[model samples]
Target: MAADAAPRSLSGKVLDVLDAFSADAPELTLSDISRRTGLSLSTTHRIVRELSEWGALERQGRGPYRIGLRLFEVASLAPRGPQLREVALPYLEDLYEATHENVQLAVREGLELVFLERITGRDAVRVLTRVGGRFSLHATGVGLALLAFAPPEVQEQVLSGSLERWTERTITDQGQLRRMLADVRRTGVAISDRQVTMDALSVAAPVVGPDDCVVAALSLVVHADGASPHTLAPAVRTAARGISRALGSPTARRHPAGARRRASGP
Candidate 1:
């Protein structure tokens, strides 16, 4: 069967085929690919052949196909992904060693938080989050921090949308969420208590850019029991500042009091 009058060009069709593969469905058989892409079997096969030949997709042991290693190599060139991860890894490792928890780095892509990196300690709380995965802008601590610093229009959009509830503690009320965002702006951090998951809590801080604008957020998720968001705030803020400094932001200086004391002492 042919597709509807959607005016699908050759390039569009090829992109459609490629878009069929997602994190959930990383590998797909030919029929699965055709069904997911909404293309005919022959069209899917032809485009898949071309993509596979060009090293954009790869076939596995006589069955499914997945995104090729070449795509990953090319994606590594993306400044916001691998480049940011490379710069932030050492600090993230330090944070993990200090807390023995799940450390995450994320950036806003539209209204969603796209996790760029996640470092998990052996005994840390088990989280469903994955690197390169996306989550709601209102659920996670990093998401809240990013959303708090987002443009007014973006804030309005999120507020107007359906605030999906993930747990009993999830803040779905627009007014409450707004106030929480205000607090994040004032405190330079965000704390999510059992919001995304019942057993987890997260603390997050904003990462500023050269323009002193919040470009991303860094966070630590740990078990809720006996954990205090206030205690974790300083560590999250420190890591965020480190990443901001690496990003060439002048506002990335040490804590204000420490800087003042150092200047006064010398």
Candidate 2:
């Protein structure tokens, strides 16, 4: 406790410094942190020292710093994060084993998706998703699955916001994205074809919670070359249903196969 410091809200500056480390840049130098967070060098140094001592950040080899294990320990206590990972890992593994491709699990966080788990096989196509990473709701398969099942008001919010483009095929037009979402809801599947990147395609399905609400989404990503989202949809949907059932979603009971069953017969 500060014996003489003025009582005030916790420092936003500290969070900014921490937020500077992300999936794209997990390690940062003092100047990098200061620049990314818009904090002064002295201020960044001071907060970095405090956070390092507290185990919320750690020093890299010489100068750069990365997020510390202590933060992950704290994050694991969150039900929406690690708890969901614990419940979904087995099914995600099954999906991975069957396809030998990239399998992902994610949840909606406002207008973006926060990946909870990811499993990739050797030789699997590279994808932009990373565990604990965030991506726009308009481009990825899992994002579309979550967005399609979201309430109409939430959908409108996304449509009204600027749609950032990542690839030429990305749906920047509101009408096109709206139609894509409709297709996802109608078929209980989302197909992202060269949307996030030109070389990857993803098929995703929604996972329901005990309340019968879309709480998460599951996906399979593969090389865009000669791949068919329709061919992968069943497997993706099956894994999603299995995870939803594990989460106590009553609707998932209607799933036609065992949770661990692999899709068979092309």
Candidate 3:
């Protein structure tokens, strides 16, 4: 006789319902969630009601349910999210002031990177990134920096996996990507020219934690046509170091001898 499958845990079912909502579909009817999660309507209803009662979901007069403010409040407490943002914001602001471009802060989560904060000027080039959005760790400047400093196993997994190409300039070959990561490690910066979008370019640097381990990446995205990535790299690196210092990184506290030369140019 075939053994019966183990029953799914209630918490697992709850998480499935939550996962059904996303940036593309921020609101969903109970039936919508049921279909997405492959749960029966009745089971979904019960889970939804419990989540609603717990302030994880909110609905208005039989309308579709949306993620609740309470959930945001809970997510705010995560060290990688708001805490990192709090430490990085002032330096991010300084970078934004200096360049008036799109300044972004992101941290790696597995093979993906999540945006924590962004500051864009009124006339800055358009970018596809959104706060709280997840992006693959092989195409963006921030992603490249994070990947370069990532553990060897993580780097191998990304190198071996399918790399989604968003634009013609996106590097899909593993060998080329491996070389690019090496450059990022050697220079302390990553330049992604027209990788995500043809009209945009980004320069990024890694931000380390108190243990001198890279905990996040900081970047500046600008229009590709007239901008010089080499000119922008030092400023981006400097601001990233500032954020790392604020986060208590010992490496950031000790300035390298040639940092001023790099920041000021030849």
Which of the predicted structures, 1 or 2, would earn the higher lDDT when compared with the native?
1
Clashing pairs for model 2 are none
- Which rank order by lDDT, best down to worst? 3, 1, 2
lDDT of candidate 2 at residue 166, scale 0 to 100 = 90
The predicted structure with the larger TM-score, 2 or 3, is: 3
Candidate 3's C-alpha lDDT? 0.92
Q: Where does the lowest 10-residue lDDT sum fall in candidate 2?
A: 1-10
Residue-level lDDT tens digits of model 1 in 105-146:
999999898999999989999887889898999989999999
Tens-digit lDDT track of model 2 for 1-266: 12133442338678778889887798999999888876778978899999999999988568689899999899999988999889999999999989999999999998888999889888999887778888999999999999999989989999999999999999999999989999998999999999999999999999999999999999999999999888898888888888898999876765544442344323
Question: Cα RMSD (Å) per model?
Answer: 2.4, 5.3, 3.6
Candidate 2: misplaced stretches above 4 Å? 1-8, 31-46, 60-62, 254-266
TM-score of 3: 0.93
Task: Report residue 61 deviation for candidate 1 (angstroms).
Answer: 3.7
> In model 1, where do residues sit more than 4 Å from their true spots?
253-266
Which residue pairs clash within candidate 3? none
Candidate 1 — what's its lDDT? 0.88
Task: Put down candidate 3 lDDT per residue, 58-94, tens digits, no spaces.
Answer: 9999899999888999999999999999989999999
